[model samples]
Target: MTIVETTSEVEAVVRDTLAVHQSFFLATSGSAGPWVNGAYFAETGLFTLSLVLEQRGRSLAAIRDNPVVSVIISTGSPTEPFLQAQATARIVEDAEADEVRRVLLAKVPQVEPFLGTPVAAVELRVLSWRATDIPNGWLPGRDLYDTSIPVAREHRG
Candidate 1:
């Protein structure tokens, strides 16, 4: 059976995974084969994403070779590290780039500085997701799916 999750199920997992981590490994390919780069990603919405690019060399090169990409953002909790949420990447075109930027900048700081560089803006349309056990198998896909992510109480910022 093809287990494509419902939009809510997908959104729940994406939101939870996004909240747990600030960055993800973006995988891409070139004439060599495959490559992965890391960056802090902003989940603007269900079908939108934007990540900080310190430099766009490798990533932009890969995108130029091929537009397909995959991003894996995992909860690094040693207790359960394999429970990762993934997003399929689609390089956003110039026309829609500003819209995605606006959504991401709302939650992120110092975005304008990064835009000064020749950076890349990637859009991710979440296809499927699987959340791990949460103190009784009540992962986000279960009845406890909650999208509310309040600012972390211990956030020093």
Candidate 2:
């Protein structure tokens, strides 16, 4: 398989991945340290994910202390050992409490009636993205695998 080399191509694949994978790993770090966490996410836009995070949880607290965070979401296909990545995370949130909550709740219907929920709202803005293909053993190429070629096979007598 050929790796994408253009920004538009990257964006399209990332957008597709974001649509396919609703849950992504959210990693956060504080002034003192860094920690990784997982959660179910909803996309607010092509490159935006809005989720209601526990206000006091390590992930939320860390982001509060240090807004920088990392998120990874792979194509759900069974690519194993070579699944393609969508994008990198740079967590951004709404300053207006209600707005943040609104965006988060909009994506998650179950959050509709949780008015008193103590979770902070956030939108992870993807900063940079990377894409790679699985290594199919045979022909040599960039990695240990060879690139897949396009062709049409015909069956004839």
Best lDDT goes to which candidate? 1
TM-score for candidate 2: 0.60
Regions of candidate 1 where Cα sits further than 4 Å from its true position = 1-13, 52-56, 80-88, 134-157
For 1-157, candidate 2 gives per-residue lDDT tens digits of 3444444554555566666665667777687587877766777665456776776788877776777677767544435221222233434444655665666556655666654666666666543444443443312212111112111012100
Total residue pair clashes for candidate 2: 1
Best by TM-score: 1
Q: lDDT per prediction?
A: 0.57, 0.54
What's the TM-score of each model vs. the native? 0.63, 0.60
Candidate 1 CA-lDDT value: 0.57
User: Lowest-lDDT window of 10 residues in candidate 2?
Assistant: 148-157
Backbone clash numbers for all candidates listed: 0, 1
TM-score of 1: 0.63
